[model samples]
Target: MDDVSWKTAVESRLDFLQRENLDLKAALKNILRENENIRSEFEAMKNILRKHVQDTDEKCNRNMKKSANKEIHTSVEDEFGIDPERDGQRVARIVPPSTSTISSIAFYSYLSKNSGPITAHHTLVYDVSHINRGNGYNKNDGIFIAPVSGVYVFHFSVCIGGSAYASFEILVNGEVIGAVNEESHTGMGYREGSNLVVTFANSGDHVFIRTQRSTIGYVFSNDMCKTSFSGWFLTN
Candidate 1:
């Protein structure tokens, strides 16, 4: 072969190889662009998912804090004389006697006065009154005072002769608040007493007990105050 033919063949082969290299470089660039786009899309999706998870966690934490705060408030209100069932309002309170013993001179008495505007005072006497047999003794003398504004439970009891029958009742503002009946004796009369409970109106109410049957024996000392009927209050 001559020098001119050899030179032409070499140039043609070089041109074909250069074109193949150029095509390979273009394909590689396109693949790299597609890979970069896929990576960017994955990063964006991950950021969105992270943001949603963080938001959900924040919402749950807020709800839990609110519930805990409400429970704490309710407990505090109840401890401070506030009725949780009554929208955090103060209710009535019943104060019982320090001692629950009957003295020789047993008597329970209270003055009739409104405790709404004026502060009322009450006193009880534990006295034993002697009564003649076959003659009826009426020693129904006592006073009840309201301390706070709310419903109250009044309890009363009494004993008479060998057979004990008592009339226990409750009063609100000097009015009958519950059923009053003679409690008949079943077993040992001297040992047992009549028990009763009644609901009284809030504030300014009075309660007392009277003997329904005549007593041949002296008014004996019993729990409440003494020989006569006794009454007290308790808040419901």
Candidate 2:
């Protein structure tokens, strides 16, 4: 109502607004500082991840180079009867082969295929339901043919139901390399034996497993991790 009273009220209102403004500015500053801290932490994490990835890639490259170096041909001069220094030279660097050769093939069984209840004694061939890499194995004929000249590793598992006796021999090119047997069971749902052999093979050599000539039994091949046969070419 009075001029002096009006002026005093307006000044009081102005003082209150100035205090509120200062509070708002302080809040904004705190927000900006928090944002900067988060950004710095985020940048630090990104740098650490990048460094880990870089180290892993460098380690992989070093391992690959070391593996390649180990693949170089070593001469066996004593077996060939030529002087170690005379027949062929060993090279240090990795050289590309003149001819490309197929070197990898593997197969595994997944289901039941009967080996034999037919004759008193027979060679066992496995059934093929699943194959992993290559088809060097003939599931129909129960034989594996090498796809390249190399040392190969072969594994055969023989599982059988309640039976008198069972024995299997692993054969490479018609010669027995090794054998595995399961025998003398009074009560059995399933019994298994496995054999592994690492042997030299030329391209097109055949490999298989056969039951002993007098053992009258059958191999149980199934999806239940029973009888399965697998082989892979190791090196050429």
Candidate 3:
């Protein structure tokens, strides 16, 4: 072959090889870009799966806590048979001693170990006196109500004239439970204190003290009129 023809053939072959190399590089770049996109998609799927698992675990934990609380409440009710969620009943009250003349007295309600703790959610105070005497004996002066179901302790006291006999009856829901009666002393008159305990099934039960005579006098004090309860429910 002639040198010029051979040289021309060699140049044509070199040009063809360069074009093929350019095409191959472009194809490889596209493959790399596609691989990067696939990897990003896989990472996104992994993140979503992790979030789903965490949410599912949290939901299960919440359900378990709720079930446990329900079981505990049910067991307590079954054993005690007393449901504070329902009706309320009065459990205790302080009754002032009976007096013949008009006098001021006080009553106190206290918390006991058998009773539950006193909370804001439960508690109520009724008329201090069921029937207040304008200048004489008052019947409406010393009454208290239970705020919740529990055991309660009550204390009450009264003072009468030196020469007169002082007598007081403690009543729970209008029923007589205790009494304090004594002859008056020359200096102190008649001062008597009484303590009574009662268990209320629930809440809203009434407790009061009534004077049997008019000459008997009574006085009520803040220290004498207090109510406290417990947090634990009693069971058989």
Q: RMSDs, each prediction?
A: 13.8, 20.8, 15.1
True-structure lDDT of candidate 1: 0.47
Residue pair clashes in candidate 1: 105-126, 105-127, 106-125, 106-126, 106-127, 107-125, 107-126, 107-127, 110-143, 173-205
Give per-residue CA lDDT, model 2, range 128-220, as digits (tens).
536745568877777888877788889887677766467778888889899888764557677777889999989789888777655556656
TM-score result, candidate 3? 0.35
lDDT score of residue 89 within candidate 1: 74
Q: For candidate 3, write residues 1-236 as lDDT tens digits.
A: 99999999999999999999999999999999999999999999999999999999999999999899778755555555534445633222233222322222223233211212223212222233333222222223434544444454444444343454534555656666655554555576334445444444335555555444443333322343322211122321
Kindly report which residue pairs in candidate 2 clash with one another: none
Candidate 3: residue 147 lDDT (0-100): 47
Considering summed lDDT, which 10 consecutive residues are worst modelled in model 3? 112-121
lDDT (Cα atoms) of all candidates against the true structure: 0.47, 0.71, 0.47
TM-score of each: 0.38, 0.55, 0.35
Q: Model 2: how large is the Cα RMSD against the reference? A: 20.8
Model 3 ranges off by over 4 Å = 1-142, 145-153, 158-167, 184-202, 211-236
Q: How many pairs collide in each candidate, listed in order?
A: 10, 0, 45
